[model samples]
Target: MSAPYVLVLYYSRHGATAEMARQIARGVEQAGLEARLRTVPAVSAECETVAPAIPEHGAIYATLDDLKHCSGLALGSPTRFGNMAAPLKYFLDGTSGLWLTGELVGKPAGVFTSTSSLHGGQETTLLSMLLPLLHHGMLLLGLPYSQNALLETRGGGTPYGPSHHAGADGKRALDEHEISLCRALGQRLAETAKRLENNRG
Candidate 1:
């Protein structure tokens, strides 16, 4: 059998969410799991618009098979109107096949987001990402206050998951606390998934 891996899937605009995904993937690797980073293409209003099969840069586009076989998941997106961005939602909306087959049931999952403002719907965006994972029957994980960064963060760390305030122009880098929380979520998800897999074994 192929080695188990955690899928770090995201849709990044202006790069903040992508950076968070990278941090989370690092944490996953630190916890001794493979991290597969994948992203979705942009959404276009015109029905005729289509993205290339491979993205020109950054992580390659995600496939349903990645979601189906992942040992765990860390989903991230840039916030849009207090919710997850449309491309991520668009990608997720197509997972009905996996939901029907319960391919993701019992897997550990967590969420993260980057927003342009402190109150720009970070938590709501995170929650929005979790809804579909719940439908897939995945075990959800979130950053607990024990992480310390969650309490100390003035930027965008939250108990719901990890978040980053990318400033109004979406140019701010993640603060130390936000980065720590992101890593913590990734490590927690990896550890939990490993434990669950061992139990099954």
Candidate 2:
């Protein structure tokens, strides 16, 4: 069997969320677990439009098997009207098979998001992602106040999950606090998953 890994799955339109995923993956590795990065294709309203099977750049599209076999998961996306982006949501909606089979039950999971403004519904977006994970019976993880970055973040950090304030143009880079919280979440999930696996053994 393949060694266990944490899946860092996200949909990034402006690259900010993608950067956060990278930081989270670093944290996952820091906790002695492999991090598998995956992304979903963009959704389109036009009936005739179709995304290529392979992405031209960045991470490849995630398959249900990715989620099925992951030891843990970190879900990230850019905020869309106080919720997750359409592409991420659309991809998740297709996971009914996993949900029915409980493939993700007991796995540690966390959420993160980037917003165009400081109050651009970061918390709501994070919560939106949590709903599906909850249904899948995953153990949800979040940054605690014990993390100094959660207390001192000037850009974006929350107990719900890590967040980034990308400004109106959506070009702002993630500040130190935001990055720290993202890594912290990743580390927490990895550690929790390891603990759960050990307990099961």
Q: What is the lDDT of residue 68 in candidate 2?
A: 95
Residues 21-48 of candidate 2 have per-residue lDDT tens digits of 9999999999999999999988887752
TM-scores of the models, in the order given: 0.97, 0.97
Report, for all candidates in order, the number of backbone clashes: 0, 0
What alpha-carbon RMSD in Å does predicted model 1 have with respect to the real structure? 1.0
Residues 72-152, model 1: lDDT tens digits: 999999998988888988999999999999999999999999998899899889898899999999999998888988888
Residue 65 accuracy (lDDT) in model 1? 91
- TM-score computed on alpha carbons, candidate 1: 0.97
List the global CA lDDT of all models.
0.92, 0.93
- Number of clashes found in candidate 1: 0
Q: Tell me model 2's lDDT, rounded to 2 decimals.
A: 0.93
Error of 1 at 41 (Å): 0.8
